[model samples]
Target: MRQIQAIALVLILGGLGYALWVLYSQPPLQLSAGQADHVSTQTAPLAPVKAATDVTLSAINTLPAPTTTADAPDLTPVSRLPEVNDEETYIPPISPSVAAPAYHGDLSDHQAYLVHQSAQITQLKQDYIAAVDKKVARLESLLEKGIRHQLPAEQLQEARDKIQGLRAMQAQLRHELAQ
Candidate 1:
C-alpha cells in the first residue's frame, strides 16, 4: 500500500513539473533589426522631406524663328463698337411700400407654447431616467445577492412592460416636438 501511494504521488508531481517546464521553456520571440526598425518607424510620425529643385536642362543651339503669312487680315479699331448713354438705361430701385408679413404675435405665441410643452417633456424624460436607474439598481442588487431566481415571471414581465411604455411615451413626445 505504501509503495503504491508513493508512486502515485511521484507521478502526479512529475506530470505537474513537466507541464510547468513546458510552459516556461517556450522560445523567446525575436524581431530582426530591419523588422524592429520598420515597426518603430511605422509608429512614429513621418517628417516632411524637402524636394530637390536643381533641375538640369539639355544643351541646345538657337533654332530658326517661324515665318508669318502676308495674306492675314488687319485687327479692327476698338472705338467702332456700339455704345449706349446712361440716361437711356432703366434700373429699378427697391421700394418700402412692399410690406412683409408680420409674425410678432403669432410666432411668439406659438414659440412660447412649444417652450412650455418642451419643459414638461424634459421633466418627464428626467423622471423616466430616474425610474430606469432605480429599476437597474434593483436588478443589479438582486443579481449580486443571487436572488434573481426568486423573482416572479409576472413581476419581470411587468417591469419590461413599464420600460417599453416609458420609451414609447418618450418617442411620441420627441416626434411631436420635431413636428
Candidate 2:
C-alpha cells in the first residue's frame, strides 16, 4: 500500500511540474494596436465595438426633437370660455345631466353600511369556526373510542355526517370572509 501511494504521489508531482514548465515556455501574447482591429468582420463573430466619441446620434433617430416655444401653433377658440372683465364674475362649471352624487354624503353612508356588514360577517365567521372545532373534537373522541373497542355503526355514521356538515359550513364561511 505504501509503495502504491508513493508511485501515485510521484506521478502527480511530475505532471504538475510538466504543466508549469509548458505554461512558462510559451511567449506572452503580443498585441500590436494596429493589427487588433482591421475592420474585417470575418475574423470574429462579435459585433464591432465603437469608441464613445466615435458614434453620432440624431434626436430624430429614436424620438422627435422637441419644438421651441416660438414654433407653437395657436389653439382654435372652439370652447365657450367666459372672458372675465370683472374680477367677481366667475361661476363654477356644473353639468346637471350626469346624475353623479353632488356631495360625499351617499359615499360616506355606503362606507358605513359596508363596515357594519363586515362586522356581522366577522362574527358569523367566528361562530362557524367554533362550531367546526366542536364537531372535530366530537369526531376525534368517537374515532378514539371506536378504535379501542367496537362502536355502534349508527353512532359512527352520525359523527361522520356531523363532521361533513360542519366542514361545509366552515368552507362557505371562509369563502364569504375572503370576499
Candidate 3:
C-alpha cells in the first residue's frame, strides 16, 4: 500500500511539473493594435461554401429601391398637440340608458328578494361542502390504499395534502355558515 501511494504521489508531481514546463515553454500571445475583435466575413466569400453544398448562390437578390413620384400625396410634419388642462376637460353625465335601473320595488319586496338571494347562497355553500366532502372521502380512501399497498411516499404525501386541503375548505365553509 505504501509503495502504491508513493508511486501515485510521484506520478501526480511529475504530471504537474510537466504541465508547468510546457506552459512556460510556449511563446506568449501578442495582439497587434490593428487586430480586429471579430473575423471579417467579407474577405472570405461564401460562394465556395455554397458550391461545396452543390447549391449555386449567385449575386444576392435585393428588393428594388422605393421611388418617390410627383403624384405622391404631400405629407406634412406632425406639430406639437395643443396642451390639455384638467379644468378644461368636460366629461358628459352618464346617459340614462347606461345607468343602473333604480330600484322601484317596495321595502317589503326588496326584503323578500334579499331573503331569496340569501337562501340561494346558503344552498350553494351546502352543495360545495357536499362536493368537498366527497373529494375528501375519495382522497382518504386513496390514502388508505396507498398505505396498504405500500405506494411511493410522493403519491401518499400528495393524497394526504389533498385531504388536508379539502378538510380546511370544509372547515372554512362551516365557519362561514355559523356566522
Task: Report the number of the highest-lDDT candidate.
Answer: 3
Candidate 2 — number of clashing residue pairs?
0
lDDT (0 to 1) per candidate = 0.65, 0.73, 0.75
> Which candidate, 1 or 2, has the higher lDDT?
2
Model 3 is weakest, by summed lDDT over 10 consecutive residues, at: 33-42
User: lDDT: which is higher, 1 or 3?
Assistant: 3
Please write out the lDDT profile of model 2 over residues 1-179, one tens digit for every residue: 99999999999999999999999999987767666664343376855658988766667754756888689787666676645556434355686665422333346698776776667669768877877886688677766766666778877777778778888888888887778
Residue 178 displacement in candidate 3 (angstroms): 0.8
Tens digit per residue, CA lDDT, model 1, 24-119: 999876999999997886698855656756544435533444556665467566788656557634356676774433334455588776776667
Best by TM-score: 3
Candidate 3 lDDT, tens digit per residue, 1-179?
99999999999999999999999999987756455432343255553454466776455544445567775677654665555667735466685554433445566797877876777778778878888976687678768967997999999998888888888888898899999
Give the Å error, residue 138, model 1: 5.7
Backbone clashes for every candidate come to 0, 0, 0
Off by over 4 Å in 2: 1-114
